[model samples]
Target: MEYIILVITFTLFIIIAKDLAHHKKKNPVLK
Candidate 1:
């Protein structure tokens, strides 16, 4: 069960990271 939760959390983290990266790319001011 804990492993499943960990995997879910990791995927969520990756999704969030990708979203943030996309946002940064869209708005150069963030850099």
Candidate 2:
């Protein structure tokens, strides 16, 4: 379903954002 796909995409986006934030905090070079 479209809604399910949307939820999946949103979840993936949040996960990626969290990972990027964690990486930035871990490595100052990205900041």
Candidate 3:
């Protein structure tokens, strides 16, 4: 159960990071 939770959180982090990166690319002000 603990391992499953860890995997879920890791996947969420990756998705969020990708979104942030996409936003940064769209808006140069973030840089």
Name the regions of candidate 3 deviating beyond 4 angstroms.
none
**CA lDDT of every candidate:** 0.96, 0.95, 0.96
| Sort by TM-score, top down from the best | 2, 3, 1
- Off by more than 4 A, model 1: none
Per-residue alpha-carbon lDDT of model 1 for 5-26, expressed as tens digits?
A: 9999999999999999999999
* Residue 22 error, candidate 1, Å: 0.2
- The better-scoring model by lDDT among 1 and 2 is 1
> What TM-score should be assigned to candidate 3?
0.87
Q: Write the per-residue lDDT of candidate 3 for residues 1-31, one digit (tens) a residue.
A: 6999999999999999999999999998987
- Reference-based TM-score, model 2: 0.89
TM-score per candidate, chains pooled: 0.86, 0.89, 0.87
